[model samples]
Target: MQKKYVTIASFTAALEPGILEETERYLAIIILLAGFKRYRSWRVPIAIYGSALLFGLSHLGNVGWNGETFEATIAQVIGVMGSGFLWAVLYLYSGKLWIPMIFHFLMDYLANLQSGWNSAGWQFNGWATDYISEVLMVLVPLIVTIWMMYGKRREVLEENADRLMNLPVEFNRY
Candidate 1:
């Protein structure tokens, strides 16, 4: 006897969560910006860091839900912040939410496939390389995000600050 598997179904199931997560996080950024409207110069920084930190903290609940180890969960939270920051910056830089949504979806989908949707109770074996990889995971995206938001690329966010923040007028003067 042979068994059939529905790979497309698994991929489709993975898609919804990524889109919803990114949408919610980005909306939170916009809301943060709106709330800080009076502090025009600090709005972008607050929105990006605030939303990204919230996104990372959200993963903490996964430790309880998925039985993930505390240490592993801590690493995941830190790593996810980098990813969240990168996504947020990508949205700002491209002036398109879909860019980050697609990246987020693809990343989640691939991870799901790699782990076969059975990531519960995963742990680090304490290899030196494991620690190095964990650090790199967090640092690389953070470095990239910082680079993307500075120098020439900063102009992109400045040009679309109003649109990205959902504000009525330009707020990037600061």
Candidate 2:
């Protein structure tokens, strides 16, 4: 019973981080779009990559705040950049924030479950397996996101670009 309660509590707690991170991602997208508004053709990609970069860098706080090792934090940052890009692509492709929010929640929930809710900071271990896993983590999402954005999928981005940029609907004709 106690174990069940802990599992439930951890599951709920994971949602907090997901909500916070997604909120930050959304704000980054909006800010980037606003800043690059004049670069009409480039605004969407700029927002995607810029926000992903910011999302990745945001993990650096774990080094100081959680006492994570520099190497571990760096790996985490790169891994999350790919995730951020994927989430951003999911958002744009679906034209719905909830899609990415759910993805983020599931991801955090699984991490919390694996770490047993309140585990200590991550360590690099300096193992070959760690390096391989980290590399795959970064590459898989990047490749998948790139695939998602190709061909007709890009049209989804264009269709939603004006709304994302907060421009008037008529501007979408351009």
lDDT of 1 by residue, 47-153 (tens): 77788888888877768546677887877777778888888888777878888889887876676676655323445667897689878877888788667656567
Q: For model 1, where is the 10-residue window of minimal lDDT?
A: 1-10
TM-score of each: 0.82, 0.85
Best by lDDT: 2
lDDT of 2 at 109: 75
lDDT of 2 by residue, 1-174 (tens): 234435776777677767888888888887887898888777778888888889999888788446778888888888888899988888877878878989988877776776654222666788998889888987888788778655677767756767877566542432
TM-score of 1: 0.82
The local distance difference test score of model 2 is 0.76
The candidate that achieves the highest TM-score relative to the unseen native structure:
2
Report the CA-based lDDT of candidate 1 relative to the real structure: 0.72
